[model samples]
Target: MAYNCIVLVKQVPDTANISGKTMKDDGTVNRAALPAIFNPEDLNALEMALRVREQHGGQVTVLTMGPPRAAEVLREALYRGADRVILLSDRKFAGSDTLATSYALKCAVERTGDYDLVFCGRQAIDGDTAQVGPQVAEKLGLPQITYAESIQALQGSEIVVQRAFPLGKETVKCTVPCLLTVVSSANRPRPPSARRMIAYKLAATSLECPALLKQWPEFETAEALDRYLAERDQKIPVWTAADIGADEEKLGLPGSPTKVLKIDYVVLETSESRQVPATPEGASGLVRELIQDHIV
Candidate 1:
């Protein structure tokens, strides 16, 4: 049976290179000062979902919650083989913590119904909470498999997967229509295909359509979009929040419950030491000293 899959991805600031100045005095991220990139583990999740589509005949839809600029990742997903991409962006979605974020995502997922499975990264590198997937599953009232290392088998409406545990690994089976949080080890995400990238380079999201129309009044109707898409070899479908019937209150910042309280910078001090080489007998004596010091 063909299984429809939805993958959730995120664009996050590169936190590894973060500095004190990266955070504002209000404890919010200085987004202007940071470069955005797709979350690493989320890419793995998308790869796993894409593999499912490859093995079983189905469409893979990618979803993300971010600003309008985040549409860049959706196009990137299309270039990487996603059948459809939806951008859940609104000014109200700003300053969302994990709880609010999941709520909005759950709404988006419901709007894109008819999927048998949902995949998400274990955690966002910037947030590092690892709570959105499970929270989304809870909101949707679906079975969840967290920290999935690999999908062993998918047959009919049942799926068998290997999950990673602290002490050891365990294989678990679950019914279809489940949510899964995947680790970076799940699979290697494929690089963007050159042809697809070139085709979709100027693709526009629904939010961007108006601006495009304002700039180029020549292409105004569905036919115009179709002709443009054909000539450009791109997929450009505009979907509004009204089309998705998303609740306005449950979508933006007002629907979210978590808030960033503070940002702190930490510094560490270390001492440096040098080791001296020793002759054979001196080495033996050093070994004896190490054994006595429990350092052997």
Candidate 2:
């Protein structure tokens, strides 16, 4: 029997290139200032799902919840090996904390029909709380294995995974229909297929049709373009909160209980840096300085 898998992925702001405008006064990230890229760890999760499909003969569906621009990641997934990609984009999902985000994801997962495995990255860089995946598991009432480093084996109705802990490693066996929060150590994700990339380059979600039409200009209407893309199975799905049967009260900021009381932006200066000659004494001095500064 084929084991169907669903991979939850995200497109996050490239925090490494953060600028002065990266944070707004409201304490939320000003994503407009940063280029978006596929979340690194989520790519590991996707690779794990694809590997499972390759081994067990099943389909991999990728799902993400973000704005219309988030379809870029969905298209990237198609260029990889995902059989289907769905975008959960609705205005109501804005400003959602981990609790609210997991709630929406739980509903989306339920809507995707039956699946033998669910995969998610351990955490998103923008919010390194590492809460969403396990929260999703709790919301779905599914057993979860987090910090998963690698899949060990799959027995009848069960799966074994090697996971990492603070000081050691562990191998856990979980039943099917379970969620696995993968870490970056799981596997090296495959690059996009050149053939699939060419085939799916024009894939677009309905909300993206207007921009596509502007770029292509061959299509007279967005609806016509949508139909054309859909015919070729290149149209990424866009689902709203109502589409997934999510309660409005539990959908977004309203459902998010975590409040950001304050956000302080710190700017490092050259004076903060200390240098010493490259020697054993220098290393000892550095360790002493770290200890004195309470940074070690």
Candidate 3:
């Protein structure tokens, strides 16, 4: 019984390298100011999907929504063993909150035909809301298992998984055709294969034609380069809002209800310090002072 799996991935701004210029005055991410990298937990999700393919015999298709440059993540997925990669990109998808983002993703998932499983990261570093995966599941009307640590069994239509919790781990059993939001602790993502990398290095989306032309100046036009890539099955599919039949009103800024009224960066600095003695009485005194100051 082979399953058809789809993994949703993202290329997010490297939050570890964030600076003052990371956020714009409008409270939106200044993506141009930071380097973009594959989301960490999404890699875990991808690894899980790859494992499913290896074990149960299935195809792993990767999908992502972002600017045209987001196709880089899809290429990385190919190098890591994904069978198919698609990019959901358009200007209309800009400024989407989790709600709108999930809506668009739900549409894209539907476009991918039948699938027995969907995998997603627990959250994206840039937003950290941890809402998109569950939201997508809800929209797709599928059972969702979040914070999955590992898969224990997949027999017939039932799947058993271990989930991580603050207190401990819990085992959950759900039927097939469900969605899973994977945690980083699930499994270590495998490094890209050198052979796969060499095979897919030339794979690119139509949006990347301009940059490709710069490297291969022999191409008389971007169309010619696109033709060459297409001929070799290297052109990644770029889907627009209309391509996926997404509702315009339910996408982008118009669909987003959350508004950021302010953006502030908080920095903690010790302006003054007091040294308390290690003795019990000294500790008691410090506790009393903290209580009086309402610090605890």
Candidate 4:
């Protein structure tokens, strides 16, 4: 049997470094100040799905929900060996929390049709809610396994996976058509293949406008684009909300029930003191002062 796997991924803002100017007065993230990268754990999930396809003859499709710029990650996925890629981008999807996000993703999955397995990262850096996978599974009525570290075995329609728990790990066997959330320990993502990079450098997805073709006459016709995409066999196919039969109300911001109540700046108190020494005695004195001031 030919297995089909779908991997859900996301692009998240780098939250480690936050500047005073990074937030708008309205409390929304100042996206301009933050660099965007694929959620690191999601790449681990993608690696796991790719390994499954390598072991079992099957195709791997990558799906992501983000803005038009999110297509960059889809291209990156192609370079990593995904057979196909889909971008679920729509204005309505903006400001959606996990609940609304999952709804949109489930609709996209339904539109994709036939698939035996679905994979997603344990959590996103931006939200860290880790609710989308389970929510999608609930919507699709599929069995869900979260925090999976590895695939212990796969026999026919049943798959044995090593799932990570707070206390330890457990192996669970589930049938096909199941959803799995993978932790970073699941697998290490491979670097993009040099050969594929050169070939699919300009592959077009549906999210791309016809204007791109006009701007670059080389990909003017579908036939020309096809030839170019075939050269590397690493191009990601794009899809629109309509292509996926997504419910208008259930997509984008209008369909979302969650809202960002408030955003505020957190400032930490600082002191100007010169350390007398770098020795343990100096450290002890600093610790004493911190304890006295309740700043430790």
Local accuracy of candidate 2 as per-residue lDDT tens digits, 1-296: 68899999999989877765787766566867789999989999999999998888888999999999999999999999999999999999998998999999999999999899999998888778889999999999999999999999986698999998779999988899899999998899999999999999889999999988889898999999999999998889999999999998997889899888987665445686666989999999999988999998
- Please list the Cα RMSD from the true structure of every candidate, rounded to 1 decimal place: 5.8, 4.5, 4.8, 4.0
- Lowest summed-lDDT stretch of 10 residues in model 3? 262-271
The Cα local distance difference test for each model comes to: 0.83, 0.91, 0.94, 0.83
- The digit string of per-residue lDDT tens for model 1 on 115-158 reads 99999999999879999999999999999999998999999999
Model 1 scores what on Cα lDDT?
Answer: 0.83
C-alpha displacement of 233 in model 3, angstroms? 0.7
- Cα deviation of 263 in candidate 3 (Å)? 1.9
Residue pairs in collision within model 3: none
| Candidate number with the higher lDDT (1 or 4) | 4
Residue 115, model 1: Cα distance from true site in angstroms: 0.5
RMSD in Å for model 2: 4.5
What TM-score would candidate 1 get against the native? 0.77
What is the number of backbone collisions in each predicted candidate, taken in the order shown? 2, 0, 0, 3
**What lDDT does model 3 reach?**
0.94
- Where is the poorest 10-residue window by lDDT in model 2? 265-274
Q: Evaluate model 2: give its TM-score.
A: 0.87
| Candidate 3 lDDT, 118-195, residue by residue in tens | 999999998899999999999999999999989999978999999997789989999999999999999999999999
